[model samples]
Target: MNSETTNPKHGALPPWNVDELPAPLPFSLRNALRTIGPGAILLVGAIGMGEWIAGPLFVVQHGRSVLWIATLAFVLQSLLNLEAVRYTLYTGEPVLTGFMRMRPGSKVWGFFYALAGFAQLGMPAAAAGCAGVAFAMLQGRAPTDGDASMVTWITVAIVLVSAVVLASGKKVERLLERLSWMMILFIFSFLLWVNFTFVPLKDWISTSAGFLSFGSIPENVDFVMLAVFAALAGSGGIGNLAIANWFRDKGFGMASKTGNMGGVWSTEQTLAPVGRVFPINAENLKRWRDWWRYAIIDQSGLWMLGCIVGMFLMTNLAASLFQPGMQVSGVAAGVFQAAEMRKLWEGFWYLALMNGFWILFSTTLTNVDVLARVVADMAWAGGAVPKKMPVGRLYGLLLLGFTVIACFGAFLGDAKLLLMILGATAAPITAFSALQILRLNTTLLPPELRPPLWRKIALVLTALFYGAISVAMFHQIFSR
Candidate 1:
């Protein structure tokens, strides 16, 4: 018998190359946070659209009560992220690869997921938003119709620079993780200073209460904006899927045995085409539990809590600075806030713009990396390209292609419209992936490693939640 047949539960796919799971890092709050990497990358990629622009816009227009949606979105998406990671932990392959392990196989699911990822992230909205901030910083105002060319070129520059950064790392995940930590520290430190100095205590209490006041959605709420808010509120769409890829690259769990995407000109890629599974003995089970605990803390504490804090701070600042019904939208959300803060101290305007620039730029950089990495990964796993080509070279080619596409896509519309389309597209994709992840975890995994009943329920609810958002959004679109 093959090694995998030693256990009857291993029949879901091709036989796994059996191996022992490595011991997990020591579990303390500080050690756990320091050792974890993927969540930081995920958090930085997430904060720009929802926290900075969409969530704040909703609060400024409707009220802080609308933040309940952000809270719920974060909770659901966190579960989705954890489940995605669960696959990577076992198989040493990305969750997208895990989706390919389902019945129809890699060829079919690969094409569908590649299409889905492109649809969700194709437009370089965050880069455009970053350019808008740069324009205000340079020209002392927001872009208008006359300045479209200038903004487009600025966005192109940002995309190109992101490619360069993505190429610089020894392992792409480490570079992203380091950048994420630095940016998070600066972003939070500045935001905390702004909040403590300017925002009133009562506004803080109200915003905190708003998150728990479930079902407080305003009657006249802009469902379109709400859709965008829900999607971007966490690592919505393909960003959530990419979390597994990052986990694999970061050498989490069994992924330590797999190869990761490397810098340009790195060694030949040797990632396992199929995942390796461990025998379900007591020792492996204990190690599995330790790894699972670390994953929970990484996802829940750093990613989920960070997203919540980001939404809360951004919305609270908006609620404090802007008037209700202010018509703040798009890049103007940041512009208006800076304008208001300038009245207090002129430097606040400049600082606010810089902060927005970092927030949006981080997302743009990570989005560019995510699109290129995922498409390359799918192509590699599905044998769509020559197996001999290095994965990094494939990623480099795709990154170049996406940069060109994003430059053209930037001219498709203004930042807000582009971001809205991006988020809205992600809702359906997230829903579809949630269902696939549920299936992958329950069926492909051994009973020992499969998620418990509670996790399964959460995954079902996650799919339904985003599914409803998708339906509501399409209904709004067609009815109009």
Candidate 2:
């Protein structure tokens, strides 16, 4: 057995490693796509709710001028994500765990991280509630008067079913992975087809230019626009941190050595031991290089591509289909437009409604799962939970707690407002996570494992970019 030291002060475990770990396969398009699982999961969690609701909501109001911001956000987030995974690859610990290791230690930062996480508790609730709106609409309960009784009931039903699915066992990850891909294929393809078939060539051209242009926000920008911008910028919010855990669970790089937290029904209680650092050597260096290459492909190909494409398509569809001065409200706005589009083409309405519902519900599922995982990781890393208590039990408790919060929000009956409030709250958390990840990558890793000078510069800019947006969002909120 390997001898290891545990830092009693901060609950820090010894560095984790395993002999004979899985090596990344040779680089190829096929191989890259095969490694698409984590990033794809990130994509679904990121774009599912925001693109459907905020993308169109913004485009309908501002005419795609703000899309450039969304694109820029994706680019910056990709870098932040790359840096985050780097620490995980080297350490076999979640990125947030790295944050816990910062100056004052896990206990101090874990409190702040947990506090930030509470702000995001509204996200999954808002997502499930939006999906409930779509479900209500599908059942012919028009939200013309903003009555959400049907939506409330449907949201509760979705949360309950999702809880059951999660608690079903250790197989939840695989099940969610498969379900995410199916949703992506069906929803993305349908949106692309609809936009191409219905949206005019000139509108598409104009919107494409808008996406590339750094156009001005309308002088009349309101709380709605600020909220939309915040939502688009952060996209995935605190849940993005979950990407590192997903990478670990997928057995990427060093994470393979650190066993993953089991699913909701798992009875395993004790956390896996954190491995020790591999002594710098030619073989280990080569392994790091191979893992870095794999990380780039996975981050660029899936996370960046999925978010950018999904946002662009959704925005374009909104700009093409809805004229200025039209009232656009959250998921209902998209679903109703699809209903209108169906009048033009038979069988189109179902596709639109399905896409809308799938996006929101899928996000709800992933958000709940990701939050549970993150919190559980924090609990274990911080030594807050007793070793005798099973991880699955903690995960289940948190998941159920979030679902209950969501049910309460659903009954409150304002999906759009609820989502906006949640989105605004997410902006600062995004900035915090980005900044923390940058610090961890720069200071924690060995000089050889640290990102190069150019990436270091880019990471700084990424953190600042998020910081500026977050500050501006708060300014807007307070000024209002």
Candidate 3:
């Protein structure tokens, strides 16, 4: 593709660039392990916010019974994630771009989702969570009013540093994949050691039962907290949608033909504003089946499986360590857990805090990428912005703006309030996108490529579940 082809005439949008499908790498446990990445990234991002902070907080307050909410959300989101990736496998575009390709055109959906994505993830809650952990590590105690200014500055620095690290990478997606794997290994290893060494078998059994303990709600329960936990128990809102962006960049399925977003300073690759869709044929269909199998393993085996284990382990540790009916919430909740670990051994305290730091920091870094990637793709594809501009350049600008906004947002409240705001805002967006994904996949893809009946039903249920959560959240807010 020439510069002329890459750059559309001033205001004109480029047409969809159609192409033949490339054969997927054969599906095998080995091949799938090598091929899989997006799910790992998603899993790392999913680990911190809900599993570390929200999940344990809920268990501490409500006991393990309500964990069924997280279980259900995880199952639904796995299906939601696979369905979103389904669109990208057929058309080498992020699912958000597919949303732009829907009725009412790009301008309407693009503007709406751009705002929605920001609204959903704009809070630097994860960074704020990191700041609290960092401050505790430094000061040898949790932060308080006198330490507010220091914590706020630390939050800003964390956000700024995330921006620099993201720019330093060769490709945004590749950088995230490497970082996620490293963090996952260290964080999970530390978590497992702590759980096994400190947490007892009976507690683990009790927590496991809590997940299957459906419809167990204590009286005067905080509906708001439960709603937030449910939303974030997996990847939460836009995080689920962002999986498709990572999948596209990973060159899965049709995306193998369409180029991905390059690094901020990279000029080597050029991504088409519109994605290419392959024809429906026997060869393409065969490749599609193989791709579908890989997708299943990526989501179910890696992403969902990781979420289940991560949530279970984190909650079990909290249940065993923290006293039931104790009040704990937000970023401070993690600090509280670290403080408890100190009772077992002083060294365990530092390890626990550092583990908390990595979990939250990884999410903060990934959120930075997701916010920029989704908006940049939407604007570039929508033609709302200059289509000729490199997506990397646009992405860089958005990254700067998102960082600045998050810095200011750090002072708005403590990490807990900010995360609650994050989850509350995210719930509606998740619900809306669920239905859009159902529509987009059903209408845009060929008949043979559309999601089957069971998948379609899951999508509907996902939308309805989140929709109900949104309504309940608002009522809980106003009624209070």
Q: Write down the TM-score of every candidate.
A: 0.96, 0.91, 0.95
Writing each residue's lDDT as its tens digit, candidate 1 over 1-480 gives 333325534332455677888988777777787668799999999999889888887788888888888888999999999999998888788888777767777788888988888888888888888888888899987667577778878888887888888888777888999999999999999889999988999999999999988988787667788888899999899999999999988888888877688766677665665567776788878888888888898899899999999998888898998789887445454466677788899899899999999998899888998999898888887778887788888888898888889888877877788888889988888888888899888877777677889989998898898898888888888988
RMSD vs true structure, all candidates: 2.0, 3.4, 4.2
Candidate 2 residue runs with Cα over 4 Å from true position: 1-22, 123-133, 136-138, 269-271, 330-334
Which pairs of residues collide in model 1? none
Better of 2 and 3 by TM-score: 3
Q: Which candidate number maximizes lDDT?
A: 3
Instruction: Give lDDT tens digits, candidate 2, residues 7-81.
Output: 112234443443543567776788867765777777777775577776677768767776787877777778878
Candidate 3 structure quality by residue, lDDT tens digits, 1-480: 333323312222345666778987877899998999999999988888889988888889888888988889999999999999998998788888888777777788888988888887898988888998999999888777667788889999999999999988778899999999999999889889899998888998998898898777788877788778988899878899999999999999988888888888866546865778776667888999999899999999999999999999899998998788887544475587898888879998789999999999999998888999999888778775776677888888999999899989888877888888878877788788899999988877767778999999999999998998888878988997
Question: How many clashing pairs per prediction, in order?
Answer: 0, 6, 0
Model 2 lDDT, full chain set = 0.69
For residue 30, model 2's alpha carbon misses the true position, in angstroms, by 2.6
Q: After TM-score superposition, what is the CA distance of residue 236 in candidate 2 from its true location, in Å?
A: 3.9
Evaluate residue 175 in candidate 2 and report its C-alpha lDDT on the 0 to 100 scale.
68
Model 1 misplaced stretches (Cα beyond 4 Å): 1-14, 329-334
